[model samples]
Target: MKKISILALMMVFGVVANADTLENVKKQGFMKCGVSTGLTGFAEMGADKKWTGLDVDTCRAVAAAVFGDINKVKIVPLTAKERFTALQSGEIDMLARNTTWTQSRDTSLGVNFAGVNYYDGQGFLVSKKSGIKGAKELDGASVCITAGTTTEMNLADYFKTNNMKYKPISYDTADQVQKGFEAGRCDLITSDASQLYSLRTKMKDPSAYFVLPEIISKEPLGPVVRQGDDVWFNIVKWSLNALVTAEEFGVTQKNVDSLAKSSKNPEIRRLLGVEGKMGENLKLDAKWAYNIIKQIGNYGESFERNVGKGSLLKIGRGVNALWSKGGILYSPPFR
Candidate 1:
């Protein structure tokens, strides 16, 4: 019985250790994605049993690039504590959760962040009754934070650097932390500003909990994949770039086909596969990016539909805007 258990574990590890995510995804005819259990605007399911969110679109865009079909994906809902393990174990091809890309995670976790999809920052959500007007007011407050995350370190660093002291109440899941906050287990909850808005919408009275205006730490959140597969990594990276690049080139789902035929801009023409074999460079179809934009729209479109003014979150683009504007969403040229 002991040997059987060991043998099973070894087999699982062997598969994970040897499998090529790109080939596996191609063979399976669909991409496997890990996502938040249920974070509004980032990753969530609706009444129609269909998944929709900004991160979900990331998965769809990748699928469209691979199969020319955006719907060919399987979303695996995972908790904050389980997301990394699932990705490392080859249980999922990529994680499109609202996960922050940090130095420790990038260097130590055997995972590589493709690119920043949303540039966020840490903030606090305090109940209105607490009357915590600013970060300075919470000197000894008990902050609710999720476990197995970079938040713990940031929380300690922020308080220490500011010469403030606080207690921490940690949980394994976002839902647990939010529940603890709602039940009055902590004085405040600290996480990415975007998540604070997402959690606000889940509150019994969202109006009662407002995020503090103090931005504490930078949180560049994006998709992640295993580290060893360069092909899979580039595919995921460029799929996201496809969205941002499409937006920059004035190509969108509604107009990409037209632009592919009529656009006079050399970059746009090459990007839309009218002149160069951009997709061939990635070992995919020439229409790879065209399919992504035509199916998933651009990054801006996904943002508006899932979390921006167009969605219930009502969050602003802020630092997520294109680099040509004010924000820093810049993508490399297809060349």
Candidate 2:
């Protein structure tokens, strides 16, 4: 008997490598998504205890792409301390918990961020009773902040760089930070600007507090998946790209079907799976992107409904807007 080379044997035996995150997700029948423990407008349980927000929508979009159904997902709420651990341990397939894409996090952690869903910056939320007018006025003030987060480091750097002093009242979770701040254990609470707005609404009197005008540090928040899995990375990356691209081309959910069938634009056609083999490259159905748009809508739509003017947070698009509109959001072509 003649022995064949490994390549020839594979061709003859019809053996294909069987390892990828997509296969695992398919086999499990649901995408395990990590999210914030409870941060409004990003990922929070509503009155009905059902998860809903911008981050949650990111997970749903991935589910729509993989399973052609947005409902096929399991929400794993993790604190700042637990999010990366859960993703690294395979306890969650991906994380969409408004995590910042920093140099250290991207390089040191065994994870890769997909894209910036929202451009944010650190800001302080000061109670009206404190009469704090700006972040600069918080010298020697006690601040409530979550532990094991970039918040602590940024706070220290900001105060140190400004030649100011502060006393930190730290907790392990964002919820505890909010509780501590509200209970007057701290003079102010600091976090991302958008997050501060969301946390403010949780107050008994939402109007009693306001985020300072100063945005101290840049925080480009987005989704993340474990490193070393290009298949999974592509799926998550393109899923986000599809959303932004759909928004750019005006391929909204209400008109996606018509656009997919009758659009004269080649780019829109490719995005909607009317042309191109993008889904094939990702090992998903030809309509993977179409499912994401049809089910979850585009990035703009999700932002508007979850954290933008339409939501309780009422945050402005600002830097989160598309590149054409002067913001930095740019997505790769579908084809």
Candidate 1 local Cα displacement, residue 139, angstroms: 1.7
What is candidate 2's lDDT per residue for 43-125, written digit by digit as tens?
A: 99888978999999999999999999998999999989888877866789999987899999998676899887888899999
* Inter-residue clash pairs, candidate 1: none
lDDT by residue for model 1 (153-197), tens: 889999999999999999977788889999999999999899989
- Quantify how close model 2 is to the true structure by its C-alpha RMSD in Å: 7.2
List candidate 1 segments past 4 Å from native.
1-14, 17-19
Question: Global lDDT of each model?
Answer: 0.89, 0.88
Error of 2 at 280 (Å): 0.6
Residue 263, candidate 2: Cα error in Å is: 0.6
